[model samples]
Target: MSNVVARDIELDFLDHDFEFVGSENVSTIDSTYASQPYWKDVLSRFVKNKGAIIGSICVVLIIFMAIVGVGLNEHTYDSQIIAHQNLAPRVQGLESLGIFDGSEKMTTSSGTVEVNKYVSANGSVTGLEDTYYWFGTDVLGRDIFTRTWMGTRISLYIALVAVLIDMLFGLSYGLISGYFGGAIDNAMQRFAEILNGIPNLVIVTLLIIVLKPGLLTITFSLMITGWIGMSRIARAQVLKLKEQEFILASRTLGARNFFIIFKEILPNIFGQIITNTMFSIPNAIFTEAFLAFIGLGVPAPMASLGSLISEAFKSFTTHPYMIIPPVIVLAILMLSFNMLADGLRDAFDPKMQEM
Candidate 1:
């Protein structure tokens, strides 16, 4: 009787172990796993990449500085004060004309007087006294800090708008050519090749000269040639993706070409698109800046990073501070953007297996 009782207890323990293993297998095979869980895992892996995280933080901080730095400070971008000309940056709570007071003297027909002012240096004050320069005024006697911030806004704006235009046209052209690969594809590709053969800088320069040099013209010239590379990339991606089983399944269901190409394929290729876009932004900015530096971008009274650098170049021997700051900003921006592009490529590539 004791032996039989012991045998029964052993069988009961073995049965409990088997039951736990079966439950584990069932949970593993469950098909309804949430997407949020997958995203959390990806985010965790991404945050672990120190360089990528630092690059991302730099980009965010630069953008925030672009937006809020000017408003928080008292300088007006175009303000010129002869009285406050060429004053150094604040030191130990000492107040100067432009940096601290945010006001300057206005000259009248009779004489000079002061006004309780807002929007400093909006062409309000004239005949700059050329005394006590603050932050080393530009040739126009405008505050350097103010002009720098304004230039940031202009450069960023042009890049964003131009890239958006390129993305729209390039994606459309590439998708159409890739989805219907015959005579149409051949013709479109040949045309793009022709555009590619021409030098982009020459095209931009010619456009600037012909159109008389404005922000819009430079942006337009960039888009015309810029889309070609993106189109090629998109078309290649589409060719590979179109052959997948999921695409075949969608086709079997009688889904239209537009639905298959856009809804099915486009979503899958967004990772590539995002990476390309990030890479393209710096290219656009640099090209625009180079052109402006050469006197072919954004005409006078409108400032850009490149134009600011150009202005600095003229006086670099006299005032090294003027040239160095803009150049540093430009370099940092380009490097941050490139790093970010690389990170996106790593994160988004479906074939890339993370360790």
Candidate 2:
């Protein structure tokens, strides 16, 4: 009987030692809340993305080169050196390290030394004089490197301005139209649709044809249709959000319509607005490049990447390097913007975090 009782009475902590062990492993649950704001969470997530960080760095570098470097450079983009016309790329002491390829031939006193671009007609190769072309000179002897960076700065600025215009008008138009539904929304949307029916490419082309290609002309033309896209996006966001509980609560609290839309609704929709703007930047840039490429860009003496390519295309065989640098820069700028947009989209998406 005693052996059976001992076997049945197994050791167990059915009643924990409340006095000694206390509540080390167990406790009554209490309310908890994060000390940070929602934006802080978003920022934290954005920082975690490696691609976004890299893209941000590249964008900054590009902007810095465009503004700071261009400002500091002594060689103006348009300042021509006719004597140094068609000079191939060369750097001091880096020719042996393959800065200039073997295909690069220059007329030196030593019977046409290959890859020697830093030679003047003094009959003696003094090595890297004023003839030093970092990325070579064009047929007109303009520094290709300087012009390329300048063109980038111009293109980016134009695109940025266009996107800003789109956002300002679009966001306002959309928010108002969406917030006030019924006949107003219907009429506004129909008008937008009618305008949208006409292709933007055709509009810009025709505008340039009429006004002639200049900075102001191109900017005005781009603005004509740019805001329509932004408006549509804004309208959709406002529509989706206007009926939310907070929005209704704001309205019920006697908040003015403007305050409700701008203060209450706009804050929630900032992510989408920014992401859309980022995406539009590339489009605007490509459009500007295309216009410039097809003879509708900035006039001669003012170099643009597209215009440079167009000029270089005529004698590509003679000076192919002239075109390569601009193309590469343009591609990198577009690519970095796209990467940034994607990263922002992913970072802002709550569903992605849950996954």
Candidate 3:
């Protein structure tokens, strides 16, 4: 009778509640049966958020495209298709056999050019029948596909490294300021305020003017100036959490200053820290790109999206391919990053779950 009553009640609840209905027949869900686990509930809610999943997927795909699509698969990014320079993308009918069959000859307008197989376009043969640059070519005729991917690799690298540096310094400074108030806090706050008053772009420009412009210089310029925002965030979090009973209890127990800040205080602020870090990435990437565009980023042979744009700008009137590809890629990267940041902000938002 007890078993029968229990079975009937379970069936009634499952029929009434979507959560119960979804978990039916799953032993793990059955074992809990009444309340959802915190992680499970969070994940369930997250999965329901299509935007977050889409944003995450975009982030993964872009990173993958920036890596394997750009890096390991290609033989030489700098390899010149000397004969196929200025060829429109994927021209058909000019297909030729490779090394084993020997380089085939194509009767182009220029002359009978010896080369590898012509890449295919749509089903129809292109007007550039004898031509075939997969991503077209620049005026000087560097491979667009290679250059774009290379730019992605460089941009992502700079963003990642610069953000890491900002996180460390920002978190440290903020925590110290918030936890140890009075003279130390006053001094650090004043220092940050002074630094923050100076425009970051102007500072970056000055540094480039004084120093040799390269990857390291670009990274250092951003790193040196980027910590202010994150530090302020950290300090604010510390101020809120420091006087709480648990913190006071920990202090009363004679915990070390470092342990109290890192172990006790920092953990509660982890969500904000993560959100701030995510927010910082696109800023760093854009800053680096802007600097490069202004003639202050990585030198040639090491290309960033911004520097690539600068190169493309030189031939915008004649060969737009050089400019178009890099600009499109830069736009996509920036937009995707911003979307991902928004998704992370929502994910970390405590208010959303409370609602």
Candidate 4:
């Protein structure tokens, strides 16, 4: 009901309100565009994780040393030098460092005294001054450094073989069972459950009784039941994915059963499979080491981390250094693989991207 009054608007100030600044320099493409292949994205995420990076470096270094370290010393793993038995770690150039100087304490008649083992054992350090036993010698005078790496090599080999076996057998079994569900699935699952019911220790004991205990026997023992876990995982993944839209599309397109499994389904679940395989490697290594520790590992003259630790256990009080290297190596291997698997799991998980 009031009278309307009109005033002159500031049209000149409207220019500043719509002022364009650096528009020509701006990019037209989307800055947030991050489209990449799945594995590339996974690799990028994995590398961003500091723990995974460190774990990868440790694993690679361990593998490299396992391959190259065995021949670095003149002494073979089985060579026995009675006089050099239980020699402390020594390095030619590191003697002045006070560590790894080949010195040990002895309870002489005069009381305990620390003496340079090289000088005491050889009567003179002249010819032996340059000799280095980086990890010292065992009771049998075998080079521990060589044996430690050799043992790692054997352990890695066994784990890889076992995991490979698991992947092949389990992946196939699970794919077949889960892809075609019904009576076949039930029967196959029942068989798997029956096999899984048997304890691993019992199987190993039976194998030990029937066959010679060595690398092959250990590998066989692992194979007997190791695949069950992988198969179960693969079956779960298959069951969850088989009825999905993409799988249904592939099936509707007349894709063969094997084609659907290995081609369509496998690529989708490959990340989980790889993660599971990495996790399994540490278990296999630990199992082998445990078997070796319990006097059922590889026979004497052949060294594994487990056997090395077992041999070192007797003299651990006197020569504690012998146990340190193998224990540290085993710990690092197990921890590194676990970290790597964890990183892979997170990286491959689609939920992580949203998070």
Task: Give a tens-digit lDDT track for model 2, residues 1-355.
Answer: 4554445566666554445646876777887976887778878888888888888888888888888656555688889988677777766577668766313755546675455446545568654464456778889888888898889888888878877787777789899999999999999989888777888768877887788777877788767777788888888999999999998898889999999989999999998898888888888888888888998889888887789888888868555677888888888888888888878877788575456
Cα-based lDDT at residue 33, candidate 4:
81
TM-score of 1: 0.75
Model 1 score (lDDT): 0.74
| TM-score of every model versus the real structure | 0.75, 0.83, 0.75, 0.87
Query: Each prediction's Cα lDDT score?
Result: 0.74, 0.80, 0.74, 0.87
Can you give the lDDT of residue 331 in candidate 4? Answer: 97
lDDT of 1 by residue, 1-39 (tens): 555444444433554465444564665555785556644
Clashing pairs in 3: 96-117
Location of the lowest summed lDDT over 10 successive residues in candidate 2: 99-108
**N/CA/C clash count, model 1:** 10
By TM-score, the best candidate is 4
lDDT of 3 by residue, 234-334 (tens): 99999999999999999899999999999999988887888788788888888888888988888776777898899889866545556877788787777
Please tell me which model should have the higher lDDT, number 2 or number 4.
4
Arrange candidates, best lDDT first. Answer: 4, 2, 3, 1
